[model samples]
Target: MQHYRDDFPILGREVYHRPLVYLDNAATTQKPRCVVEAMTAQYYETNANVHRGVHFLSQRATDLHEGAREAVRRFINARSTAEIVFTRGTTESLNLVASSFGEGFLKAGDEVILSTMEHHSNIVPWQLLRERKGIVLKVIPMDDRGVLDLDAYRALFTDRTRLVSCCHVSNVLGTINPVAEMARIAHDAGAYFLVDGAQSVPHFPVDVQALNCDFLVFSGHKIYGPTGIGVLYGKEALLDKMPPYQGGGEMIARVTFERTTYERLPFKFEAGTPDYVGTHGLAAALDYVSAIGMERIAAHEDDLTRHCMERLSCEIEGIRLFGEAPAKTSVVAFNVGHLHPMDLGTLLDRLGIAIRTGHHCAQPLMARCGVEGMARASFALYNTREEVDTFVDALRRVVRMF
Candidate 1:
């Protein structure tokens, strides 16, 4: 982890005349030098519109663009590149599914099941679909420990159930839900499963085939790549039957005043000029993590999370930690002795320790936890135990001020 820290140039900078300790990985990760350089090289050498022209620059740019698609396909172990559809980010990806799939398959009375702990990106899409398609939304409940109840999830299914969308890992809490088993249950009840992988992809390996999910969406920025680029992966058969999410230049085969034909597979969903440079950078980020190996990275972050939890529990009096599931990841949410999370977070920022303070886009989960918002510390592979110690010490100092 120490050696990998050098690859990210932003980590060396100081904030407020103090060394910066970044723990807000759930929001977005710091980019590595290779990712930045990869995007820079593509823009400098092969800056051209892709998939339209036969000129040398267009051909080169198109190849790099499609090559990134293949890289994403391999990274998630998808069956083929045909299933990968690029979008702006996870929010757009979820909206794409809600619009296209709802228009194509969901009837007026169809139901989509979601979990209590899901981020708003996953929950709001279906709510929008409900408005348009008259679909009913069902929720799978979780316990105080932030673990979803599998038996209750099983009971949420019915004949009208059309889809089950859930977070692979909670962005607010660190709960790693059992998506594979949830997918199986959804399949048994004749419902398509979609996993929101925005929080999980950067932490552990996600095999689309093994999960057997009909759709999986993640953002590149969360995985150490640039923003404005993300992936929506659907089973080939499902995507083949669904309507195009948006219609425009690249996603069209032929256009007529009366009728227009859409493109096939991924391009059908990708409506505008794709982010070719961002794709290259995302591929480089994926390559960087793959070289380090997901298993090794997961182990390192697991140790860091344990250390963070232990120190925060021991050093800080009147501290309350959230999300204590048996299977959890590298996030800790907490508050201390009637002190507002923003106060603690603001004081920590002054000390040059960065962490997130808010409902974290999971307002429903915040309500369930009996709080308005909580301070969050999310760890990544590049984060170290020394940083964790510093963060804990800073929190202790902030607590004393209150």
Candidate 2:
């Protein structure tokens, strides 16, 4: 792998007179200089409204905007650009699925299967579906190591199961889910599977066709792109069947006093003047990741995760690590004994060691683990082993203080 740190310019800066160690990647990643330059170049030279203007600048803007959609299509290996719809973020993407597809297919007594380790974004959408349509919500249990119980998940699917929505990776636990198997089980049971790829897409290469999921959603910010930009990939036929989530100019084919018709597959879901700058930035982010190679990024992050895990296990005492899955992502969720995660994070911040400390949008997982919250050190390709060592040292000092 190339020197991953070289791509992210912020890695060179010092904080608190110490080299900064940023491990809060699960929340959001720092943008590479390439991504920053792309956005800057767009605003400085080519800035125009997309898809509606007739001038040269408008054509340029439209091409860049649509090119981003194609980039997203290639990023996840979706069937076509028509299957990709832009949204605000993963939260909005999942909500779009729930509001459009969920409302169309789900009915009273229909069951929606979700796992216990899902983030609130995945959980709350199904809850909304249940409340509005009287649909049944079934939760698949997880093992002690934070891995989902495959047997339990399989048993949860039945003829009444309308859809199965689950996370590709648990944000809090770092457990990479068996989404391919889960998709197969859902399909065999005559149900559609939706993979929440907010965590997985950034950490690993994703081929949606290989996974055979009916839908996949991810946020741009988590992938080193701009915030407020996300992609939702749906099967063409499924998107055709689902009703529009919103109504506006871009998504309509013809509007009249008597009747109105919607546009084709993807635009039918995106119903307003979209986030043009954000999409351009997202395209640049994907380009940057592609240049770096996803496999190398994943390998780098895995190395960092293993290093942190080893340091915490062999070097630190009285630290209770959460999420012990054999195959995991870069996140290390844990807490030192008798120390609240917030306090640990505060001290670590003083030392220029950034980490996340909270429920991490996975309250159910925190409850299952019997902890109020955890201190999480999540990695990205831009992070380094030296940063992990610094984080470990800071953690040791925090443990000693209490």
Candidate 3:
């Protein structure tokens, strides 16, 4: 295993006079020095608008910006750089597909399939589509262990099903979904498959070709990159068929007051002045992860999660852990007796231990688990067994106080 903690400078900092134990990685990760320095260098040394500038600095900035797009393409193993479209984040990426592609293909009688573990980002877009297009929305249920009932999913794929969208990993439950299998089933039924990879991309290796998903979306902030930058990878044929998500400067091939024609695949989706700094930071973050090796990071996070589960199971009294699936990520969602998740989070914060509380943007999962919310301790490459031990100890103390 690598010494992952050395890369993150924030891990060494003190909060409340104690070292910070940041376990809220599923929400957003702390950036390494490399990613921060990369963004700083761009702003301090060579900041310029991309795609339209005639000067040298402008050309350089344009190259760097598009280079980030190619970096994202390689990061996800996309078929081509044209398949990758930059957006603000996963929310915008999914919304783009829903509004542009969904509007084009879906009709009043068509059905869209989703799973019970979807985040609000994944759910809301479809809801909007459902409301506008009169499309029926169906949900695949999950078992008590938080694993998707594949049997239920298999049953839901009728001839009316035109689209199937699900998360690659459950943000609240930590269940790693079988997206490949789902994609195969959707393909068999002639439906488009989309994977919400917000959780999966940061924790595991993702290959769009291997998964055979028609569309995939993920956010940069969760992967140790800057906010306001994300990726949407769609098959070239599909993206070409869909209308442009926005209309502005760069997305246009020709402009006229009477009529206008749109540009090519990726550019059509990326309208307006683009987040050049965010894309540069995303490229730096990708480079940082690549240098460290994603396989190694996955191993470290797996070990950390196993250690946390073992210790928390043995130490905490009156605690209930959710999502006991055989395959899961670094996220551990649990409740500490009668203590509200928010209150427990406050106590943990006093100890300089940061963890996520409440619905975690997955209210449907929370309702299914029969809890108002949960305290989630999600790990990253930088987290350690020692940090897990400290978190377990803090929980025990909090329980005693109650």
Candidate 4:
């Protein structure tokens, strides 16, 4: 992990005249040099529109862009690249399913199940769909430890349940939901299952086939790749049935005054000019992680999580830590006694320690935990044990001042 640290030049830089100890990984990861160079080289050498041009540069750009899609397919172990639809990010991906799938399948009384710990991106889209299509939304409840009750989830599914969407890992709690088992349950009930893998893919290997999810969504920025680029992977059968998410030039097979037909599986979802350079960078990011191995990265982050939790609990008095699920990842959310998380986070930032504060785009999770917000310190593969120690020590000093 320490060897890999050099690949991120931002980690070597200082903040507020102190060494930066970045722990806001649940938000986004720092890009590796390889990813940056890949994007730069793509722009320098092959700057052209993809998919329609016959020129050499256009062909090269299209190849690289589609190659990045293949890279994503391999990374997630999807059956084919046809199942992969490039989107703006996880939000758009989820919205794609909500809109297209909603329009194609969902009816007025149809029900969709979600979880209490889902990010707002997952929640809001469905809510919007419910407003438009009159679909009903159900929630899977989690215990105080941030663990979703399997029995409750099992009981929530009715015959009318058309879809079940959940985050693979909670952004706030870091609880790794049993998505594979959940997918099995959803299938048994004849409902499509979608996994929001924004947090999971960067930390662990995600196989869409193995999970048996009908759809999977994740963002590039969360995985050491560029922003404004992500993926929506749906089973080809389902994608073939669903309508296009947006109407634009590339997604059309033929345009006419009276009628029009849509293109194939992925391009139907990808409406406009795709982010070719971002795709190249995303491929570089995925390739970088693949070379390192996801298992190794998971192990490294696990150690960092355990170390940070132990240190925080031992060093700080009356500190209430959240998300104590047995199956969890590197995020630790907590608040010191009688201390506002925003204030604590502000002070920590001055000490060159970066951590996320506030509701973390999961206000429902915050409300469920009975707090307005929590300070979250999330670890990444490039993080080190020493940085965790620094963050904990700085947090302690900040607590003492109160």
Q: Tell me the whole-model lDDT of each prediction, alpha carbons only.
A: 0.93, 0.91, 0.92, 0.94
Q: What are the RMSDs of all candidates, in order?
A: 0.7, 1.1, 1.0, 0.6
Top of the candidates by lDDT: 4
Find the 10 residues in a row with the least total lDDT in model 4: 264-273
Better of 2 and 4 by TM-score: 4
Per-residue C-alpha lDDT of model 4 across residues 1-402, encoded as one tens digit per residue: 799999999999999999999999989999999999999998899999999999999999999999999999999999999999999899999999999999999999999999999999999999999999899999999999999999999999888999999999999999999999999999999999999999999999899999999999999999999999999999999999998888988999999999999998789888889999999999999999999999999999999999988998999998999999999998999999989999999999999999999999999999998999999999999999999989988998999998
Q: Candidate 2, residue 306: CA error in Å? A: 0.7
lDDT-superior candidate, 3 or 4:
4
- For each candidate, how many residue pairs have backbone atoms clashing (under 3 Å)? 0, 0, 0, 0
Better of 2 and 4 by lDDT: 4
Q: Rank the candidates by lDDT, best first.
A: 4, 1, 3, 2
TM-scores vs. true structure, each candidate: 0.99, 0.98, 0.98, 0.99
lDDT of 1 by residue, 241-285 (tens): 999888788899999999999998889998888999999889999
Total clashing pairs in model 4: 0
TM-score of 4: 0.99
* Candidate 2, run of 10 with poorest lDDT: 1-10
Q: What pairs collide in candidate 4?
A: none
Candidate 2 regions with alpha-carbon error over 4 angstroms = none
Which runs of model 1 end up more than 4 angstroms from their true locations? none
User: So what's the TM-score on candidate 2?
Assistant: 0.98
